[model samples]
Target chain A: MSDMRDMFVETASRLFRDYCTPDLLRAAAAGSFQTQLWDAMVEAGLTKAAVAEDAGGSGAELADALALLVPAGANAVPAPLAETLIAGFLLGEAGVVVPDAPLTIAIPRPGETLRAVRKGDGWLITGAVARVPYARFASGGVTVIAETAEGPLLAQVALADCKIAEAANLAHEPRDDVAFNEAPAQAAKLTTRQAADVYAMAAAARSAQMAGALQTVLQLSVQYALERSQFGKPLGKFQAIQHNLATLAGQAAAATAAADAAIAHAEHGAGSIAIASAKARAGEAASIACNIAHQVHGAIGFTAEHALHFSTQRLWSWRDEFGNDAFWELKLGDQAVAAGADGLWAMLTAAA
Target chain B: MEALSFAPPPVSEEAERVRAEVRAFLKTELANRPPFKKADSWNGADPAFSRKMGAKGWIAMTWPKQYGGHERSALERYVVLEEMLAAGAPVAAHWIADRQSGPLILKAGTEEQKQSILPRIAAGDCYFCIGMSEPDTGSDLASVRTKAVKADGGWVVNGTKVWTTGAHIAHYMILLCRTAEPTANRHEGLTQMLVDLKATDGVQINPIYDLAGQHHFNEVVFRDAFIPDSAVLGKPGDGWKQVTSELALERSGPERFLSSFTLLVELVRALGPDPSPAAKIAIGRLVAHIYTLRRLSRSVAGMLQRGDDPAIQAALVKDLGALVEQEIPEIARQLIAAEPDTKSTSDFVAVLAHTVLNAPSFSLRGGTREILRGMIARGLGLR
Candidate 1:
């Protein structure tokens, strides 16, 4: 199992490293699609990495497929790779045909809903979703879990048919405000439990990405401290700088462990508690790691020319994307409280 | 910088099975114990309870069976230790022996030493304390002034060791002292001697109470205490190598993070079924940290089992674990409005006072935060 994951990760890392250059990232942030990079990812069979072979994917285990995000995140790949992997799972499981082009997800925030009603044999999707990741580049479609009169159902709506207001996060990645005004869509029945699992998976993916990005932040800070000199000595020789990097390493280690635990749980069919903990822990790590990395690098890292921001900016944005630290902490805290004091240890041990 | 790897801990059915057994035992053993008393956890010594645990074959679990060990996997030992810690069991009597000293003996002891000491340790009839620090040495252990001079049948040690935990109740002390004159290389010419604290002549243990009025810490003055040649551990000049390995075992354990756990239990109990959003967020944050630290600590155990030197990784765990352990008290105070009082009747207040007073030592003991971070920086190739 570990060998298979190693092979898969090695392949994914090579592809991402070749295409996610500083020039490509800058162009993608400036309202241009990374066409060559996207084509390479599609040809490498990475777009549908997690789905079963029968369902138009490489038939790789979900854990191995999700492992690709770590390197992709390390390079700060400015694309909808994480979203596409998640979309593959949702669409393949709903028995819908996984598309060839880049796909995005319309996950509605709390107090918001996207509705789907019957329109002849097909369905029509209405309502709006704020911050639909990569909606502008999802040439295939936007996968959504829409509310129906009967129950919640899955829908794949064409991006061309919807209104997309281009928006960018801290890292300049596209997070569009997409509105579907009676857009024609392919629909399938989906349970409410599955819908909740989708949310958990999204949060888990963000955690993995944060874990990878934090590693880069640590590397950058350490390298800068060693190479950059002041007062006739490298900055790393100073106790203050060394201690700062040590703290950053600690945060990165915690996030990586948390993300690894989340992926393990996801593969084993135990998701909620682990995912919640991962998101909360990774979110906190992101905040601390970015602060230390920036402080160590000084003004050079703050400039656009340096590559440190490529990872730190994503960490800053991804941490708050799919339910920040406070959101998941509340969920986990509620579960712990409900279990009471006597049952608290039991709850943790049971999950293990 | 080399990337630090903390792979997922391997799962063992036997380990899980042992976890259930340990939990059941703790349930019965601690049924009548109150939170204030349980707060002592590994620091609370009880020889009778240690004997009971020894009878259960928990001590020396990973050692050879000939030395009264159970020959269990490292994962099984981890499960037992964590379960004991979570339930706040009094394990001070056998903790140091089972954790580092016995393992050290098994690694470097003479045949006679292992034959006599291992079984007693496994039986919980023997106890050991470390004699590494002195009045002039804390973090800089290589600069210890303690020295053992050559004698007729053994060596005579002379120097004072301070801040020695459990020295009063301990039967033996693993003394680190110079066997030769100091050279330019300070770490050289050092030896570790197994001094019989009670039987050895000229050894005086004076009590040094902590702020909480506890007698766990002590000052042992050795005025020419004699240790036999057979009591020498490994080579005479290998004390530096031996003690550092012993510390890796000491640094990355569940005890480092779970010292203030009893207070968390009381806080949860006081919060009841419903709590404010602030309280829930605070509690959830602590839980997330504990969950992550457990994975990191367990991964270090796996590395140790594989015979890898994870000294840098162990330092990182202790550095991070101590922070969360200390933070639990600060967060608990904010969530509820209760003044920390050691003499209070309320369980919450009493545990709070105990944890607040003890939190400072969490970072100080094992290794100071500054020292551990310096080691981490070295691992990162920055020092």
Candidate 2:
């Protein structure tokens, strides 16, 4: 958390709070996208914060860029801020042209690898990538990591060139499934640990976002408890409500701490252990945090109009998105078990 | 938004160096200890092991060297504590003295008290226990009625202390007693008196066995036990401040969460390399929590090192840690088909059984969950 990073957070956070109005959220959730908000973000140079300066980005530190996701998620900003920044940075890292619009990625999961056939000047991508976020309205394209005859190749393919069956996560953000039938793509330079790197970056981003959302619900729960009265006192005055909010606060705190660790480690290229713990911890914390938050908020929070739904729903969706707790936990558990009893502590304390 | 701050300090190279040294030392020290034996963790006392730690200058590490401390950074001490707990080294021998009592004595004790007590504590020969809990007063510590009446050149103590861990074997006890009539504030008249267990008269230690049938806990009765005027560790009516100041240190250690760490290791070993996805998921969730708790707890240590009060942060760690540690045995039971058995000859089952029997105390020990939650609520400005 440097002073320069603070500027990015302060500036972008103010912009988000001003532009990401409830009306804008409602419109975005109702299938009408908020272009003006995205414009504000782009004008503020947040979307390209992670891209290299030579590649026409704001050249903000990767950590500074990642930190913005907290406020973005906190405000429930219905935009592709984290994804675009990460994708743009990935493209630059692979020595490819950084896109100027909203971006998403097609990363292969544990046992799956998307393929690309080297065809002429560009590569022909062939894969059925599920849940490519923001692809439906992504003006730029989706970054795809395709396995080729020679190692792995990175490519950015236009959504118009592929079949996108539009869908939405619980938060109403587009999470469309894309099927590439020999889709022509810009053959970006290959990157090391291709899919894993992207997934790690995305998981770290999601962890930050999840941290933000957890903070939102926690505040909502506490504020609600303080305002809503019963038994001749405010809900916050009740022992039960106070305890529940305390639990929510713990969840929120753990998620925030976990997110900070994840970003810190991810920034240092600490790999799966750091990234996995961040996502797994944040997702796990969110499970308890969201439940406790909604429980504390009671019926008023259950309504679609309530802002609590915005954060909680996003948390539920985000946890399952870029690899859930179970998905990442298995990876960590595998490494730990393989290391055996003696090596477990070493693995755990290795990053520190 | 105003949650107690735990901005993790920059990763200390010194701490990492200490971590490596501790790991290497533990490797040789615990090479022969079985996992089930390790499951006893910090509760299992071994004077030899504690002496080895003391020789390494690991005990009373953050105190001044003149007081037999190494003057190491708190993070370095934290790294050592984390490694010890993870490896299940027998740290109970001097855990209390190292964690709180020695620090309290250094902060508030007379120079004579520090000269006579600290070096022995640092050498890991002397042990200490908190004489705070009584028969009726537990979480409501302000209501403690242990009396210390004025006597010739001293005070006479008459009361009983309950649930004092390691009391039967501890060399000394930092006795919290009522020194004066209660004022408008119940917490005002209490004082901390140093009690020499071996030298004291009419002091009886009766064992209070745990569910595991262990003698780690005790009931100490004092009937007109003389505490020389010099034995008062701090000023009269200052026990509340001293005890309150020590609360964060008592609650924020790796012991709070790592009590059942051996159980987690045993669970992982049982699951092996290629278990069902479900087992892996359970293990992963546990690992993630352990990692996060370490970060939070370490952050508290940094705060403590920087001379900041992190009572709220410490409470948060202790509360969340108790939930996670207690969740181990229950989750481990479901992840595997074996019933937790202390004598089944299977280390995993035995460790699970030990943990099952012990997990209930994790929340009960430092501060009960209800009390911790109340503290956290106050931290959240809800109370």
- Best-fitting candidate, scored by TM-score: 1
Candidate 2 lDDT, A219-328, residue by residue in tens: 87888888888888988989988888888888888888888888776654425687788899888888898888888878888998888888888999999988888888
For this target, which candidate reaches the highest lDDT against the unseen true structure?
1
Q: Locate the minimum summed-lDDT window of 10 residues in model 2 chain B.
A: B1-10
DockQ of 2: 0.66
* Model 2 lDDT, full chain set: 0.86
lDDT of 2 by residue, B78-108 (tens): 8888888888888998999999999999999
Residue B377 error for model 1, in Å?
Answer: 0.4
TM-score of each: 0.98, 0.96
Give per-residue lDDT, candidate 1, residue A207: 84
- The clash count for each model shown is 0, 0
Report the C-alpha lDDT of model 1 over B1-383, residue by residue, as the tens digit: 44378777777899999999999999999999889889999999999999999999888999999999999998999999999989999999999999999999999999999999999999999999999999999999999989899999999889999999999999999999999988999989989989888798899999999998889989999898888999999999999999999999999999988888888889999988889998999888888888888888988988898998889999999999999999999999988899999999999999999999989999999999999999999999997
